[model samples]
Target: MAKQEAKFDLYVFHRSYFCGKMMAYMRYKQIPCNTIYATLDKHGSDIASNTGLRQMPCVRTPEEQWLQDTTPMMDWFEERFPQAPVVPTDPVVGFLTRLLEDYADEWMWRPSIYYRWHTKEDRTLYKKLFVDELLGGFWAIGGPVSWLAGKLVHRHQEEKFLSGDGLTKANRKHVEAVYINTLDRLETIFQKQPYLLGSHPSLADFGFFGSMFWHFSNDPTSNRIMQERAPGVYEWVARLWNATSTKLGEVKFDYVVGQVPEGWEPLLRDACEAYLPYLSENAQHFEKGSKRFDWNVQGFLYPGVHVSPYRVWCRERLQGFLNALSESDQNRVREILEPMGGWKPLTSNAHIQSNWDPEGIAPLCKPQKLPLMYKLKSRFTGSNHVRTRRAWMKD
Candidate 1:
């Protein structure tokens, strides 16, 4: 066991944000696992045969069990490997950690993609990397086929993500502003503390790592901004990457209202104002079966935001965590979240009728559905806002 062996098969894409999240977590726990590179064409059939979808960052255990979805996958790992835990022990702290984690995991996702493809240099690099990953075995990488593949990916991604997600000239700057504001806040926090909450990396840190490490800090556009603007946050990316569980001491989010880390408020405020509200909108659109609808996140009007059933489930998950809390703990959490504008969304009944993951057996079992579309034809979907099988997509 170099680092720490778990005999786990982690199927991953090098640049996938969720993969980066898993990488940071497994590294933190000192879990030695093998990463098996997976693409829809080469590995889709076998993966879909097991998990019902071809979402990457999915893991195959030593016992040959398949697991998908990072939220539940982390739950599975936390239950199994509770050493040097990233999750807080106290119920109130635990719930808060999960809330921040969900925000970073879902809310920061679009902005992360915005940095990746919107930037000319990073987009070109990612397209080249994508070609090598997908078409490397077909021929010499810089050849005509590779060139065509890269071009196809760039076009497909721009169409599917950029225009499809409604990233327009008017709001593109707003998207970047969100990211920069996050960096500014995080930089301030890291200057005061080693991790987001404290010295040990919490679930919140790993969640942010999904986007920051994989996309923002790595991309040339945001990377430069990070290096110059928020060097502390930039340093944190590597720190978390190399972090070991040995340094993970007692975890705490139980501090009373005034005693909690001051840095958390801004992030949580944005989550309350931006992420939770967006989730509410997504749930509404999903209920209406709208293909795309207009919504303003943090005051930026995104006209064609895709309605995600999965995010509706995300809202449910948050509400579940909140409901499970004791009255006292719930009140304590409210002292923090209520003033920040998050309490209402977690408590309000939006008539969300999603039957997904009913058994609470996530990461152990998968439901028979896809996140966005049930099928997509494109050979390369890196799992941004949509995930599905490519087998029937080409049809």
Candidate 2:
């Protein structure tokens, strides 16, 4: 008997950064896969039915199993096709890459979605492009729900983003700042090397790129910030998806810290303040000391929040990512990430299960009864601060 050819297909939204993430990996690995454009109409529902989730960037496998979410889907691919590895051979670096990717995927997505869906001007531009650039091909096949479908999907995401509490102006400001700060840091970080992981691109690069490349870079307000604030970083972001490159000057790599130019600090600091709650929530999750916690137990608001041991552990996880590389790479990551001190010493000693099935990421595998919510609190402890010494080895 002859072996059956593998059937690989992606149901995606062209403007979606996660979709782009999957596409980048597919292209990099040279994986043979079919592409299907999913919109907000019946067809979109059809795609969602196949995936058992409304969120996109889903994959239909050779055996016709629908896999949703980027991480699990990517893990599936890594397991199936181990030849062209997206992860580094060094354990620490690989772990860091995954951690950063998670942060990038979850933290940064709010701003990209908000800017695209909320801001009137951005929404207009995006809608026009969706019907023309994104759905042009699908339209040829009589897919008329491009704009409506997109709006429906955007509305769904909006509900989720605004679900926990009504998205306030302060929330918008903070979310926007997340992108700017991330880009500022990314600009400096990438200046030290060609990719986030030194010589080669890792999941972190794509993770950041997922939002940065399509959403921010494409938007006028955010793009101006990226360009004027950190041109090199902005340019480098484009380079991740091969969207931008140098043609004349000799390429160089020299690491530097706190190198953000004048006039950018206020933007970055504002963003930092906005990000505190989200970071705080991450910390609080671990502090709850529950072996397993819902990914969204805490609301990403800008008010009083609690620190969890989980945040510290994750911070250490970031350091672990750096430790994967050679001494030089470790130095590079430390220099770039240390100044922030988001993951410093912790005051609490809490026991949390480290296993994926038993702890932090376990919710992703099982069903949940209710959505997680967090109310503002008056006091918080340093327990959420994770020191560098407590880092774990990526399994």
Q: Which is the leading candidate under TM-score?
A: 1
TM for candidate 2 is: 0.61
**Error in Å for residue 78 of model 2:** 1.9
Report lDDT per candidate: 0.77, 0.53
Q: What is the C-alpha RMSD of each candidate to the true structure, in Å?
A: 4.4, 10.3
Root-mean-square deviation of Cα positions for candidate 1 versus the true structure, in angstroms = 4.4
lDDT of 2 at 6: 75
What clash pairs does model 1 have?
Answer: 4-32, 376-393, 377-393, 377-394
Clashes of 2: 9
lDDT of 1 by residue, 329-381 (tens): 88888887888887776677656855556555666643345433534543455
Clashes of each: 4, 9
Prediction 2 global C-alpha lDDT: 0.53
User: Pick by lDDT: which candidate is best?
Assistant: 1
